[model samples]
Target: MDPRSEELAALNALGMLESDEKRVLDGSSLVDRELRDLNAELELVAAELGRLVVPVEPPADMKRRIRAKIRSRGGSKLRSISPLALIAGVGWAAAVALALASIWLWRERASLNQQFNSLREAIAPVTQPTAEKEEKEKPPARNLEEELKKLRGDFESQKTALNTEIEALRKREADANAKVAQLVQEAQAQKERDAAMKLHVATLQSEIWEYRRSVMTIVWDASKDQGALMLDKMPRVESGRDYQLWIIDPQKPDPVSGGVLAVDDKGTAKTTFKSTEDVGDAVKFIVSVEKKGGVPKKEGEVVLKEP
Candidate 1:
């Protein structure tokens, strides 16, 4: 049957048996199958509905907000214009203003320059000073020592902070390296585990394939002893219940006796047929529980079959 038709039939059957789940089950099947068309139809419906939903006016306070912004800018522009006007004053007035400004600026510049010179002089070599010059500079030397001490303290504090930051960065780098190593180890282990699991699964699949290819259920031919079958592990049979082997024979009154066989956990069994037995038309071979020898009766389902 077509997969789609089978699926639809199952859904219809379920819906008929349980009416309540009908819409829940089938309501969105077509929609899911034609998602693009559904989305387009939804968009069209939304657009049509949007036309009926009129937009309300913006809040009245927004106009007030705009007007307030304009007024604020107007005030700012007026302030900015005052500086321009001062710059564009009459040339005579500007000259006089400039002259005063230069004098004041010069005074300030002279003061700053003097301060800088004094600082440089204090930091420079202290030559053998004359008595009066030495007396004049003694106070400044004391102040300079205090300034140098303050600068040194600041430098030491910054150096300590920088050292602390460097140590923290080193620790972070070490931790990152350690974490990377751990992840690498984990990844390697995971790869090994995955490889082992794949091998185990492949082995199981191969064994199953071999089991599927076998034709005969059981065989008992000692003449061609296919090497002594290894008896790795023996199954625990019940008391007085030994595994019996038999062969179907048309010439004989019934299936002929083969020999006792043993089964192991690996599903392997072995038995040898009697050499003198004609072994004619042995259409079937089987194992069963009976006396401590072969049995002529079957008391269990056929676990294996021969073509």
Candidate 2:
């Protein structure tokens, strides 16, 4: 007859009592015969009510309607839950689990009791604190961080795209610069190839015994004082001596050094030379045997002179 005992008896009859709560009611019934009779009576009444009510066929869209109603009433979804929200959802974990257990019980024992479904439906609107809804209800700072993260992702992707474009442009610019340099070099080379040459020729005779059979020819350029010298049957210089050529101008007293010469064993040598000083209108070319490494002045024996 206790109010709490009656409440537990009613909940037990409708299968709404949790396992621990059901155990407590069962233990109380053992000591109190009135509570035991009341529980039995409540169970019989539930069964009779189930049998009396004829099953009503549900509408085709009943499930959709019920789901919409649940959502409007703040039902929470459980899919794709984040770790932090899952941890925060611990409070309602038991409620969701109990809802599942109630689902199994309703399927198995649905025939025995129909009115109990009303009780389950009545409590359905209560415990819906799933992580999804919890996230929505979070503070403004959490929302701000999510916005900032999205902005940062967009900025990084744009930066990478811009860098790729810049690199491509740089490569194109480098290619253009290289092509211009190549064209300039080709133009310079062509200019040099188009220039003309003016040369003068003279063959010198030597009267010295060692140079009698030796033949030396000078191909000179009067304007540049630069030309090639050819020698045949020439005698090799003595030890510690080198053979040097010279250019002479009718106006100047001193001769200009032409350069040194090296001869082969067959007494033949050919080389190009440029005078150390300008020799305008060169009238003479000479060869001298000098100390090793030719001197700046004509300080050696003149073996051959130009006619």
Candidate 3:
């Protein structure tokens, strides 16, 4: 016999099955001998319980007392009675019925109570552990102060990092601004130097000297010890030779070497030269061909001379 069939047999015997379940149990009981036997035993037990549950009616005098109690509680008629009044009437009727049943079953009441207590004690161990486990699984409460302190520490760490990043950016911006300022200063100084050179060239052009095959122009600023040179129609030098300029100063015994000069493809050259020594009393200028790097002494043939 299947366990489900046995359960259905028990329900059917006690008259607790729905109409559909009752139909299924009746059909199964015809073929299942164990289910049929179990159903028969359950029916016998239910019949015995039905016999033990005696139908006790309230006496006439008890009914009159209940009506008097309801009237005193402001319920004049049954039709006008509230649900509470109806519940009170039912409770009183149940009490009277229970009193009569107890009187009739007084001999069995002690045995039944003893059996009920024994059953509760037997089931206590299984139920007690489950209640204790549920209590243990519940989460403990959090401390508000500790949680707030952790949040504040995290916020302070983030704020410090942010402030450090901001300071680094400020330093980088300051360095960039300083570099831009330096470039601006250098550009302004370059512009002033160019203007001074142009002015000096104009002054030298006013006092120019011309030679037989080439023209010479000199612009000397004794205060700064610098000058500009301009030569036109000058012959190009050999591969290992270069043209050099000499400044003849009355105070110096030897002519001071000005600098080396090179002619372009057009046989014209323009350059600025500065002397290491003072040339405050220069009286004449000369050009000579020398080696690629000019010599301190004029050891080459003079090509152009200026008064």
Best by TM-score, which number? 2
lDDT of each: 0.47, 0.71, 0.64
Which candidate leads the pack in lDDT?
A: 2
Worst 10 residues of 2 by lDDT: 108-117
lDDT of 2 by residue, 50-148 (tens): 877788989999999998887887635545464444444543454565566557545635533443445445545885756764554454346445655
Give the per-residue lDDT of model 3 (tens digit) for 55-168. 998786998898788788865464776444445565565566556645644534555556545655676687774766545433221233344456557656755665565566
Candidate 2, residue 283: lDDT: 64
> What residue runs in model 3 are displaced by over 4 Å at the alpha carbon?
1-211
Cα TM-score per model: 0.26, 0.36, 0.32
- Stretches of model 1 off by over 4 angstroms after superposition: 1-133, 199-307
Name the 10 consecutive residues with the lowest summed lDDT in model 1.
198-207
Runs in model 2 lying further than 4 Å from the true structure: 1-196
Number of the candidate with higher lDDT, 1 or 3:
3
